[model samples]
Target: MKNNKPDQQLASRRNFIKGSALAAAGFFIVPRHVLGGPGFIAPSDRLRVASIGVGGMGAGDVRGIFSSGKVDMIALCDVDDTRAKQSREAHPKANYYKDYRIMLEKEEKNIDAVSVSTPDHMHAVQALMAMKMGKHVYVQKPMSHDIYEARMLTEAAEKYKVVTQMGNQGSSGDGVRQMVEWYNAGLIGEATKVWTWTNRPVWPQGIPWPSTPIAPPADLDWDLWLGTAPYKDYVGNLVPFNWRGWWDYGTGALGDMACHIMEPPFRVLGLGYPSSAECSVGSVYVGEFQRGYFPDSCPPSSHITLRFERPGKEELEFHWMDGGIQPTRPEELGPNEMMGDGGNGVIIEGTKGKMMCSTYGANPQLLPTSRTKDVSLPQTEYRVPGGSSGHYNNWVEACIAGHGSEEFKKLSSPFSVAGPLTESVLMGNLAIRSYDYRIPRTGSDNQFDYPGRGIKLVWDGANMKITNFDPANQFVKRTYREGYSL
Candidate 1:
């Protein structure tokens, strides 16, 4: 897993980051002092890249980087041949393969990076391989399937000297950057509470647990699709798209959307990993819903809670509601108020005022008519010029600059920020698994068990382990398959 030569080069680039002048088309260009160091590959110089799991999201990533004109699309790999064929059609010049490992082994010298858009279960393994080869990575959202994978990915990237960016495109939006500026300027003074909500129950609910496994589809390499995950027979629901609701291949409702909804709070408040997390759901609701994507079971609905300690600042509480459960707005806000308290959004209530923003960092509007009138955002030279093209261009620009600029180095959101958010959401999934076994909330004086069996599970991020509950710790890492030990 060591790529020392390339890593040393990247270290050199970190020392050379300089120049602040704006280039043509408003893009920042670095002076030669910043561009001459090691790990600095020129934009015009040929760079090779590969795509792993080039289905739904992967296909889009392939096209985006292709448009950037910074690299050659050398290889496309996926467990599904149908999508693989489509990827080949989309990029006729690229080579295609069923197994990513085969592609990596055969095309190792040509590739400098990898765009991993695989299912949650496969992210760490594919990305790990790419990093081991001294390749930069563009991994999709919910960066890891579990807490351990998040830590592992970060370590591997650092060890390998690869430029990395998570695929939470919303993090690149100007709206999010604006939110961070506002938060920093104290517009939302010492924010105490934050809420993120989503309407996700509609897709995978109302159906009971699936009993039997069906034959694998003709186009899928079922074994490869199940890479690094628990062994299971193929099921139709697991294919194409729809896998985000299942525990085996996905991280459930919160994992699927938390990265997007939780983006603003993480970046603005500098909130790290939560100290502990809990879940609550209606008593009537059982594991009545069948996992639409994989052969598993999940609760009909739940309200997940995550808490963080920010010494010298307000303690933050992030509440997640799926299936349309929502937070009650502060009653004091008078009439003519509009709240983004619907399916996807974050509500920040501070000492001075409150703000509501749509999910994916769009449609940001401060609450309370007076707050918008009075509060002012701080002036900063760096502003993310917003557009609809998504995060693709941002990474492309970084890749083109290579080691010469701070492009990707300056951008760490969706990865570092999304890690804990995704971990907190995974706690919701843990709560459901341990619904009959409630745990004590750390720092609480009461000895009585929670009203329901849900996790108030304590987290220890520095150690990369969950405290208090052994069962919850079981989820920190997956039981990787025999051959693939990620």
Candidate 2:
């Protein structure tokens, strides 16, 4: 009892030292939940957040997070001043910066989280930096450009001890949950096949890159926007959204919309890496006889098939159709009934029945509309407060809870889930790229052998490579620009 007095005095000394160290760091974020567990956090405490690539979809994502009203939008960064106009106007209080590098460096102490919504090539690098600093990160979909990048961020999210999410808002929706419940309830017995399609590439593809480059716009930082891609002069249409067609910048239609459309099947089936992948791309003829091969661009259309193995279940035949393609209608539905919400949808055929859903897993239905009306299953999965729209808040609250907290485990699109899904999506692109590979033949004019054509590539997911087709492995991991790397 007498020694207890010295113990109290030592505790006072420890608190004094801790406060001094924080003072030296200028400012430190002490999430309320960290000070006092879960429910003890005060209502007034707010998450401090920043946005990168605040334009177009990125702008919308930023607004969604802001609308959550749980966090303070502290900073905004984008390469194009013109593109950033809307966000800057909306969050006038936030600090604005042209380069993300500068913004992260100056705002590191103040930021608690970051939203990375840049081009596919930039997602991994930006997200990795924030996580490494122990800041939560919410990255936009397709998760990453290459398989390796996807795996990197997936692993980094845990190693850095930071909460993380990939912006596939559909994953947070009610429809997917309903579909999952239905599957578990045995409504769709044992799924063996799935079909996902999209009408995308609204921008041009299957054409040669423009020969002349235009002067960089005064408001746009072409180099910063380029990020990890090889330096190139600004091309008019590539900005403000046509980048979807290019291999170096975008992942084409599959990357553009698959995350939203294919999420249902991936979730309901409890899928994992595919055992093998193959695809047939729609080709364009350059002239009368020559096939137009734009190595720099994604194909106009593609039909890919991936085979996934389940431990004790039937193997899955997952089909991805893009460039305005559609799957066959299920016989169980009326002829007039819509098949997969018109343009983008997915159909999973099981041993017992079929289930379908539209983009974002919205408008889910059983094969026969009447069946959906009469059927009901016990709801087992948790629904976000606002369904699909609640994706932003899902991350906001998790960041507030502190990484590895119970709330963090509830995130809808944590990299652990998104990483493998993205890898699956990117796997199809590998098949497409390999489909277009050509090798010149000796003693012939414009004649070449396409070795990768018509071959099924066996994937070794553990090693992140194509076990059978060595040439197709190049796209698995991309080379980063010297200055920027994960």
Candidate 3:
């Protein structure tokens, strides 16, 4: 069945191209309705798209592009045959290649945009290369593995006149828009402190190294998978999905979830890059092996606090607690409005009244409670016009029409916000790796005195450098493998 699916996909593409040519030639033609509907642009008018790293996330992206009717999927690229096969089956009419560069060089003009769903480490290079070719880009979240790449991609997107959207799906949802609405409404006064948490500490939980290498999968090109990271023999356990836990490939739990968790606080508060950020480690994972592989023993769950000294007056602190972490609720919050365990959300404590929101607050409804009863929120419905379809649809529309509209911008324009948030999360990961260190922390609630511990690191956004701590800056920028320099 799997083998037949690829063959069928290929046949459908060949037929579509043949049929499209006939219609363009002014000959009598019949519509087959390849995509979900016929309202989208025809194949000839569609943007040519190329898919890179078409495995899990990549395959889903391919489907989105093909279904949008805004683009014709011309190429499928991936290091793994299993995923490549999935994309090929989903888009048989497009050319297929194992290596993305080969597809880029071979089908240069055949593509107008590139959808990149690779690992955290490969995002910067793939997107940068596509932008350099004048191709629009839709990359997955945490935009880049480090600060330098994030800054570079943001600049390059502007320079190349390409439309860009980072793939934080929540960024394209109504929930995020509602968060913005509530923030604008001042439901949370002043917005002094923000707390976000995740139930991570699962795969890469608590700063541990990965296990030893195993034989690479037969259908997978392991070397290509490693991409820009330092070469390590294929570890069977790490590939496919566990990459999220390792320092070399993934951004740990904080990196994986912070973009989603931090969006509300950033949008509502209009917070910029923090002047300083330090990580506090409740438990540490020691040894170089810990840096390289997953440790057999898990590190204790801990909270990472990031402090920002805002422009106006007092300092603001955003605490990111994960691995079974919860925030200390303000006394004002009703008993029933208390947050959930094994779930994710953010709590904003303000002087006037406290505002609580979950990570996935689908449709702006608060968790029902008797004591809290029904807190009347304004009946404002903010919809993601094209996003109701998919994240790639918004990008496809923007790519074809030039500039993204206000709605599209509102949906996917969190790159600037997500960039700094990712940095703070990565910094937290670094702090945890530094073992048990009493780093300095300053920032109080309501001008009250409060002292804390963690490595107090200062940041210089202008220079993209974090001073006062050298070790903290180690993860700020990454080096490229021999041939993959962007």
> Which one is best on TM-score?
2
Span of ten consecutive residues with least summed lDDT in model 1: 290-299
Candidate with the larger lDDT of 1 and 2: 2
Looking at model 3, residue 266 earns an lDDT score of: 71
User: What is the total number of backbone clashes in candidate 3?
Assistant: 11
lDDT of 1 by residue, 442-473 (tens): 77765435333533777787886667776667
Worst 10 residues of 2 by lDDT: 37-46
Give Cα distance to truth, residue 205, candidate 1, Å.
4.8
TM-score of 3: 0.80
Estimate, for each residue in 156-235, the C-alpha lDDT of model 2 and write its tens digit.
98798888888899999999999998999988789989999998878998889999999988998888889899988777
Q: What is the lDDT of residue 325 in candidate 2?
A: 81
Sort all candidates by lDDT, best to worst.
2, 1, 3
RMSD of each: 10.0, 5.8, 11.9
Candidate 2 whole-model C-alpha lDDT, 0 to 1 = 0.89
Per the 3 Å backbone cut-off, how many clashing residue pairs does candidate 1 have? 0
